[model samples]
Target: MPISQAAQRLPDDAVYVRPRMAHYAAVSRQIMAALENISPSVEQASVDEAYLDVSGLERLIGPPETIGRQAKHIIKNTVGLTASAGIGPNRFIAKLASEYRKPDGLMVVHPHEVQAFLDPMPISALRGIGPRTAPALRQMGLERIVDVRQTDPALLERRLGLRLAQVILNQAHGRGSDEVQLHSVRQSISKETTFEQDIVDQARLRETLLWAAQEVGRTARREGLQGRTITLKIRLENFKTFTRQRKLPAPTDDDTVLYRQAWALYRESGLAEHPVRLLGLGLSDWQQDAPSQGDLFDTPSHPSEHAQTPQRDRRTRLFQTLDGISNKFGQNAITLGLRRKT
Candidate 1:
């Protein structure tokens, strides 16, 4: 659902959803080898569903059915998440097949069985056909795949636009997976704070964004990452949320960049008119970047991956200096990276 529409009707108390890319990243790497002879291409859709491409590996495993069985066993044994396998010509087919039989199911659809397999399924099985579209199709006696395929492709185009209609036709004909495009860099990094109660004040919101940006920048530094994209998201009292993003001329991990870009994106996110319960800021289009230099007079930095023993001693000396400062003054007297504000 669109954030604006959802917010208008949502209850006041719902926890925000977060995507744990790190966890899923680890899982994908771990699960990659399990899917037979395939060099898996995993896209984490959520914490749960993963999109994988397993073309042509079937021959090595004897057949698709056997490959699916072996894949399921390995995933269950290793990752601890029950997964379903979908086999088709492309990623689209694989993902749809997986969803059709979830919680440890395998679906294998050869090119020959595309229409026979799809025509009986509900229209919702097709991508981009949401609840609204399903009802619309049903109203037009086009609730199933065959109903949709039987309708003139041009006629469907008139109703849903040419690109989308053709997309539907391709899927009905058993060619569901779209083109594969590689992302060049990380899109964004964001942090959000969801308040227990809706906040009507402007001052508090600014403070929260400031804190969030600092934290986001800190993480960026830790990963040696920089991004050209900055995004701001806001959740209103009604359960609606909105997000906006901006692209920068150069990638950076600087706190100033995060603050300015996020500020601009926030203004565009449609949060101004509604009382907000949550605010999020993120950076995207990330590229690997060098770490920033610190205050030279305060601390001499050591390389993170320098010879293991030397690096350890350097870190210990740095910690000792920090401890001495804390002992003499106070915790507030010292700050670094994201530790400064949020």
Candidate 2:
């Protein structure tokens, strides 16, 4: 049945939901808090999914299945939501096990059972194997996960690209990474939006860039992060994507600085003359701590000297005030003047 039709068949009492960013953010925080109590090593895969490293907890928590059940109970009791748990030697196996029996189910894959567990599944079941790639694999007589495992890596590379084939081969043989990383390990934060229709107007494009920069800055501040590099991503109407990046003299979480850098990169791309389908802004090369304050006589290192000026300090304070107001009232309570469609 079509997903839309199935959704309509549900009773009116069913929670027909719409996407709300605040609600999702709250839930994500709750989930992270819950996991932090269970294991010190927790990797958030997405807003709704995560990976927990429970390797050394056997003595305290009993078995892997017991740990899974306890984790589920905590989430249900605390967050009012039930979570599916997957326990395995590696993340790939664990992720697959979790999805195999979902919606409040628990599945455990022991070290010895990894190959057997993967044998019957189709190639598409593997992570990173998209619909387009799956058919090509099947055409090569590699139908099941077992077939891919038995195939030669050299031949696989010849058919698929080198890097992707190696990743698939490693996954097929039950060799997968199990390191659950914390959020601090992330290298970059980005935001992108695809337009409903191609946009050609320079003003609209600039407004979109400003919005993307604002979002990146907001997220960075929330995460207590600041980056030196600001990257601009533009996808033309023909679906050709291009990216340009600029490094700042000092790391910053100021949206104004991010917007200016992104705007500069966008102009340098020479795509202003073409219609755009998508726009993105990213911040990377994170600083260990907040940017340091410079003395009056310090030589300027970057082209944007205004970043070290008192005006920039004032702008930063204004942004912080606006952020507070937005948090208390709502996201749309205040908007950047540049983001306004003029």
Assess each prediction's global lDDT (C-alpha) against the native: 0.67, 0.81
Which residue segments of model 2 deviate by more than 4 Å?
1-18, 131-133, 152-154, 157-165, 191-212, 228-251, 260-281, 285-307, 316-342
Error of 2 at 151 (Å): 3.2
Candidates in order, TM-scores: namely 0.65, 0.70
What TM value does model 1 have? Answer: 0.65
What tens digits encode model 2's per-residue C-alpha lDDT throughout 113-226? 999999999998887789788888989999899999999889999989999999999999899888877754577988777776678888887788778777888888877888
**lDDT by residue for model 1 (45-119), tens:** 544555555555666666888777877777888878777888777777777788788767899988787678888
Local lDDT at 308 for model 1: 28
lDDT of 2: 0.81
User: RMSD of model 1, in Å?
Assistant: 8.4
